[model samples]
Target: MPGGLALDTILPSEIKERLSRGEQLTIIDVREDEEVAAGTIPGAKHIPLGQLPERHTEIPQAEEVILVCRSGNRSGRALGYLESLGYKGLKNMTGGMLEWED
Candidate 1:
């Protein structure tokens, strides 16, 4: 995290704004099923962090993708994992769902 190699990040508000503006965003929620049951960004695809190894291929590499979790930690990890596999246009949702409002 000390180097410039850190993954890019987007705030929850920014994501909400983009979605509200009719942007076709690809958001992947990496929280567990129970955590996601509480609520999530509408239209986000649910893929738990544990399942990403096998399910990551389902994500698009050519388009921007936002990763989310209860907090930013898991999503950051998810972003790193996907990046290692050559996926581009990835961003970690800073503060995650904890800072997401509706």
Candidate 2:
């Protein structure tokens, strides 16, 4: 993840646990194309940070939404934006792929 994470965040393990229980999840990856080429959480929808403002409609209004990025930086910002747009269940994946890659 980034050097310092803000208040709202989620851990990869917690996401994994919910998935294990067969819960429906909406995961959005806000990483850039080049960053996404490396890999991303399975089932995540790719909506680059730059495109989120315009494409936010494409994202489902699920009660829970997991936002991911390379180091959680972009995703964190995305989460905040989504919140302003009336998204209630948005969460930034803490550490992003950095911690998940571990």
Candidate 3:
């Protein structure tokens, strides 16, 4: 897996800026529906981590996929799985929603 899977390691602000600029990226929220109801990045697609393996087909393999969770831990695991499935352009939003709140 790529080093980008590490939690607590934030993606640089510049990279985030690029994402905000409408870069062709896929931001996926891996939190459960209840957790996402609390809050989520605007426009993010919700695909609970538990369902990712079977639902991988729902996600586009070509686009850059940024995984997010409550604390980034689950997303890191999802990142690894996605990598094993040969999905490229994977990224974990470190610190997850906790850091996003910061």
- The best candidate in terms of TM-score: 1
* Candidate No. with top lDDT: 1
Model 2: how far is 50 from its true place, Å? 0.0
Model 1 spans > 4 angstroms off: 1-7
Model 3: per-residue lDDT, tens digit, 77-97? Answer: 998998889887788887788
Identify the superior model by TM-score, candidate 1 or candidate 2: 1
lDDT of 2 by residue, 31-66 (tens): 889988999887889999999879999987657789
- Using lDDT as the measure, name the better of candidate 1 and candidate 3: 1
- Candidate 1, residue 45: how far the Cα is off, in Å: 0.2
lDDT of 1 by residue, 28-90 (tens): 999999999999898999999999999999999878999999879999999999999999999
Q: Which residue pairs in candidate 2 collide?
A: 1-95
- Give the RMSD in angstroms, all C-alphas superposed, for model 1: 2.8
TM-score on alpha carbons, each prediction = 0.90, 0.86, 0.80
lDDT of 2: 0.86
> In model 2, which runs have C-alpha deviations exceeding 4 angstroms?
1-7
